[model samples]
Target: MSNEMIKCTNVSFKYIKDSEGDKKEKYAVKDVNLEVKNGEFLVILGHNGSGKSTMAKHMNALVIPTEGTVVVDGLDTKEPKNVWDIRSKAGMVFQNPDNQLVATIVEEDVAFGPENLGVEPSQIRVRVDESLEKVGMSKYKRHAPHLLSGGQKQRVAIAGILAIQPECIIFDEPTAMLDPIGRKEVLKTIKELNKKHGITIILITHYMDEAAQADRIIVMDGGSVKMEGTPKEIFPRVEHMKKIGLDVPQVTELAYELKKAGIDINEKILNVDEMVNELCQLK
Candidate 1:
């Protein structure tokens, strides 16, 4: 098997505009090339309209590039026959859990994906159980999805995708609609999915703290990638990030300010724990 789970070569996408007898095309994603290794965790950061989400859609074959190619798990997305296989391998979780939830009952919703995939009935039962357990939602299997909290609902949604047994999962701002606690819950689950389960993750989020957890970060601007590096490498450029209408993690911003004040603190600190340790070293 190839080490790469996804590859986009010189990909570009344009949205068609039709109004008042005018037909024009506006590019949402420019010529971009990227590769995601198996079991890699990649976070994409961008301001609104930067095309991060559009680029993500290509991974799952949801949006085919107007020019260039997107290959997922060795299957070319532009091929009609490969579409189903590509989608099965690369499942997507959108921003809104409510929109993704289909069944009324939690377990039923979790089962929906496998059922559609034509998994054997007996195997579907096992998968539904395992998926819920993976997401820490097994205890609520019998509950109605409507009754669960926002975080719980989102976990159930994740369980649904997990039931599909995808090799890669693209999370398009999964925590945007969530509360602080809910965001924490979802982020933890995401990390475990990638680290423990060996699943490839492509997360598109605006939260700098969330990006800090990824193995690599890609910053998008004007429909193209502006910066790409590890969290330690990317978050240190506080001025550049802010100039692009994006912010570093709160701790990183604090570290940046301290460095400007002539303090001998590490400017690349990402989390509060790191900041505390850096401050203690000043003595």
Candidate 2:
């Protein structure tokens, strides 16, 4: 089996103008190359219009590249025959939970994906139950989706994808519309999926704290990759991140300022506990 799950080679996408007078071509993603290993947790950070979402769409064959190729699990996305296989391996969860939910009932919503895949009815039942349990929503199997909270609804949405048995999942700002508690729930579920189930996670978010949990971070700007590194390496370049219209975790920024003030604290402090421990060491 190959360790590489996804490979984007010199990918680029440009939107064509519909009107004759509009001669402008806007490239959403430009000559980008990226590789994702199996079971890796990768986060993408960028402001609005940074091409992060555009790149994500390519992972599942939702948006074919205009200039290059996207291969998922060794299946080229551009090939019509490979489309279903690529999508089965790479499921996408978008920002709005409401939009993703198709059925009124939770269990039905979770089963929708598998049912569409032509799974056996018995297998679909098992998968629906298992997927809901994985997201901690098994108890709500009979509950109405609209009655659930935002976090719960999102979990149901995730379960829907889980039922499809995808190897990799792309979350495009899944927590953007959530509250802090909701965000925490979704993030916890995502981490658990990656750690326990060995699912590859491609999380795209504006939240610095969320990106902090990723094994690697890729920063995008103006339809191009601006920076790529581990959280420790990427967050410490606070000035550059700020210049690119992104923020680091609060603790990292504080550590950076303290370093600027000649303190012996580490500039790569990612969380409060690390900051406290570094301060205690200095004292």
Candidate 3:
């Protein structure tokens, strides 16, 4: 049995288009070899068009590798027979809440995926309720999805994924369109899902603070892994990260500057609370 839930071995993908009757191939993802472990909170960071979304689509057979392989739960995504099983095992939550929601009522939308899977009506009902409760959306079960705030709508979309009983959840910048409160709400819910439910969480986002909370971070540039490490390990390499046009967590960047200015402070501080504690230690 494979210990990894997702594996991409020497995978590569290119987009081909006809320009003025001439064929052209542009490589979007190249030789990407990465693994996502079971029950791990892994965050992937990349600039626009860096191939993070393309890599995510392969996890569920949305797109097959042009070269190597993507295996989910030891099942090869390249094999046609495994598509349904692979998708059900690893669910994807996209950035746009509006695009993901399918029904007017919140609970109805949550039930849509499981219903399509031929789950029994009774089981679907229970799963829907459980999922909504998990995301703290049960109070608005019958509420119109459009009437809810951006955060609430995204949580409902997440509940839809949860109702399907997925082992791993891939969040593709789920909080990008949200306001600060909405972002906080979604992040807190996702953190609970990882810690309490032990579900594997794969977060793909550009927000440095969001990436800071992960157990491990994968930084991508030109569709390849530039850095992979714990947040403490990754943020300290300020020059390398800056060269890639990625920012560290706010406090970490401040500390990095302080260290640069001969303040004799640690460069790995991630949050204001951590900085406060460290400042007291120095006194």
Structural similarity to truth (TM-score) of each candidate: 0.98, 0.98, 0.98
Model 1 C-alpha lDDT per residue in residues 184-242, reported as the tens digit of each score: 99999999999999999999999998999999999999999999999999999999999
* Winner of 2 and 3 under TM-score: 2
How far does residue 115 in candidate 3 sit from its true spot (Å)?
A: 0.5
Instruction: Give, for candidate 2, the lowest lDDT window spanning 10 residues.
Output: 16-25
Candidate 3 wrongly placed segments (more than 4 Å): none
Candidate 2: misplaced stretches above 4 Å? 17-20
lDDT of 3: 0.92
Model 1, residue 92: displacement in angstroms?
Answer: 0.5
Cα deviation of 198, candidate 3, in Å: 0.8
Q: What is the C-alpha lDDT of each candidate?
A: 0.94, 0.95, 0.92
Q: Tens-digit lDDT track for model 2 on 1-283?
A: 8999999999999997667787778899999999999999999999999999999999999999999999999999989999999888999999999999999899999999999999999999999999999999999999999999999999999999999999999999999999999999999999999999999999999999999999999999999898999999999999999999999999999999988998888888999989888988996
Better of 2 and 3 by lDDT: 2
lDDT of 1 at 19: 83
True lDDT of residue 160, candidate 2: 98
- Give me the overall lDDT of model 2: 0.95
lDDT of 3 at 30: 94
